[model samples]
Target: MRTEMFVDGKWIGATGGTFASVDPATGEVLAELPEATEAEVNAAVDAAARAFESAEWAGMLPAARAHVLLKAADLLAARTAEFAQLETRDQGQPLAISAGFSVPNAVEHFRYYAGWVTKITGITAPLSVPNVDYRTRREPLGVCALITPWNFPLMILVWKLAPALATGNTVVIKPAEQTPLTTLLLAEVLAEAGVPAGVVNIVTGGPEVGKALVRHPKVAKISFTGSTAVGREIASEAGRALKKVSLELGGKAPSIIDADADLDEAIEGNLMSGLLNSGQVCAAATRFYVDRKRADEFASKVAAIAGSMKLGSGLDETSQLGPLVSLEQLEQVDRYVQIGRSEGADLLTGGSRADGDLANGFFYRPTVFGNVTQNMRIAREEIFGPVLAVLPYDDADDLASRANDTDYGLAAYIWSRDIGTANRLAHQVKAGTVWINMPPLLDAGAAWGGMKASGMGREMGWAAIEDFTEVKSIWTSLA
Candidate 1:
């Protein structure tokens, strides 16, 4: 693995101290990596700014830029297995998920954005003024600072990186400290794919490094995916500087099961969407609202499925669920589980940490709580773990209100056999993305973000292009 930080197309040792990258599955040190200092962060931003203005990058043809992204995508596809293994080792997600979902998704983002490179165009508008020409040019925002979380490091990084680069913006990335291995490796792939020097840089550190990058004057934009609290801080700093910012933050997404919904399908959808990656996803279906008459059955079925999940190391092929990202995360999940009990929600199954062979790792059993109320902490706050809180609702008339009660509005799932009812409820929900009769499915071609406190901007599809670029209106007098 590459241990040093990538800056200006070169591997440099950090001025800041080194930190150990621990394997959450075995509590073993995978690598001791360098943490970039404030000085180093400035260097990265300076490099990115220079690259953004350089002829080798900024002046290159759009087709050439697309070629670089496509080549990078091809290289990533070739090394998918290697990347998947490193992701599983570094991030503690199941190997199957790393291989099947995250790595593949990263490749697709590059390819998808590559296709957009040549297609990005300016618009000529007809104005009422005579002897004048009016047009709007979509231009890159220069250097972008991408601060990604540990849960889906590679995928989310590309969610920001692909579009930024597609629009001709150079970037400096700060991968979550806990899982920087795969991102460091990607620097090599981009270099091999002929990305110009200084166009992409990476610094590995915690919040201090992130704060420095966000506050850097040369950094024209900031794209962040993490907690809502941190997002607020970044937004505040960026607002003061007038820097463009897009955040994909925390979520407490709710899944609703209508009275006429298919019970078995709803149960399966909840298990897959809510408990995937042990529910560490920002858009995981943490809250479930079911018809009161069938609530008991839905909760029971969910508990039974969650109880059967195999918790072990990500490298273990037979393992169905992996450990939480770290010990701190494990404790946080446990605290919420305790809060659920205190709030009088019924703990249906798997409420404690896994023991035996998985005892040393940060493994929490998939937990489910029934009879959860909207006011309860477990139902409202983002647990960000494999803890599900199922709430029973009496009236369909007010179901939309009950579901939209949370501060988060990132993503929601609705299950109903009647397409009309599902469509109606989908329109009523406040979430940015609503899935009907399905689990959480994300596409590179579709926009993804939140409606309220969940976040301020979208991350995928054409929406990403808008986030990474700025419009410049050019008016010419012909008379």
Candidate 2:
């Protein structure tokens, strides 16, 4: 495995030194990775700025840039298994999920955005006056700095990279310290695919590197994905720099099952939506709102699924759930499960740490808490684990009010056969994305973001292309 920073078209060792990258499953040190310094961060920004000004890159045709991205996508598709193994080993995501979802989704993001490169344009306006002409041009925003979280490291990095590159902007990305392997590998792939040197740079380090990157005078835009606490700091620094910033922060998404919903489908959706990726997803459904009439049934069925889910090393094919990203995260989940019990919520199933063969790993069982109130910490906080809290509501109004009670508004789900009820709930819930009769799903063509304190701005689709580009209007006399 490569264990150096990529900058200015070459692999270089970090002056700030290196840190051990531990495998969450085995608690074994996988590699010693470079710890980037503020000096290195500045160098990356300078390189990107220089690249953005270079004739070879800045003057390249939009179609040519798109071709590079498509080629990169093809290269990644050819080695999906290699990338998947790295992800499962480093991040503790199940091998099947790493191969099936993370790697494929990363490939799809590049391919999807490739088609938009030439299509990114501004429109011409018709002027009423005879001698007046008006038109708009969309242009890249120079160098962009991207900070991606560890939960979905490879996929999230591509989410930011694909759009930035498609819009013709050079980038300096800092991957999360916990999971930088796949991202470093991606830089190699981009290089092989003919991405111009300095066009894409990777700096691996802790928060100091991220802070330096965001505060660098040369970076024109900042797109971040992580906790709201960190996002707030990023926004503050960006605001001080007068830089454009887009954030996709944390979420405590509520999944509601109405009276007329299909019980089996709801149970299945609840398990996957709340428990997928070991519930490390930012938009994972952590809070469950069910009809009072079906509350007990919903709790019992979900509990059964939670109790039976296989917990082992991500490399094991029979394992459905893997360990948390780290021991710290695993401990955090355990504390929250205890908090739920202390708050008078019923522990339906699976709250303790895994034992026997799984004890060596950072594994926690899929946990379910019944008799939960809207105000409970487990119901309100972003657990970031395979823990589900079930709360009952009497009517539509009650369900809507309870669902909208949290500070988070990233994603929400509505499960009802009745179209009218589902439509109304979809409108009432204060999340950026709302799904009806389905688990939360994301398409590259649709915009994804959050509402309220969850985050500001959007990612994916044409919206992201617009996010990376700035619009300028031109007026002329045509007499």
RMSD each, Å: 0.8, 1.0
Q: Could you tell me the TM-score of candidate 1?
A: 0.99
Predicted structure 1: lDDT? 0.92
Q: Which residue ranges in model 2 land beyond 4 Å of their true spot?
A: 128-130
lDDT of 1 by residue, 20-97 (tens): 898998888999988789889988888888888885776789999999999999999999999999999999999899
Give per-residue lDDT, candidate 2, residue 10. Answer: 91
Kindly list the per-residue Cα lDDT of model 2 for residues 1-479, writing each as its tens digit: 77899998999996878988889998899999999988889889988999999956657888898899999999999999999999999999998899989989989999999999888878998978788789999989999999999998999999999999988899999999989999999998999998999999999999999999888888999999999999999999999889999999999999989889999998888788888899999889888888888999999989987898888888899999999999999999999999998999999999998988778889999999898998899999888999999898876677788888988999999999999999999999999999888877778999999998889999999999889999999999887
| Cα error, candidate 2, residue 112 (Å) | 1.0
Regions more than 4 Å wrong, model 1: none
| TM, every model | 0.99, 0.98
Can you list the residue pairs that collide in candidate 1?
A: none
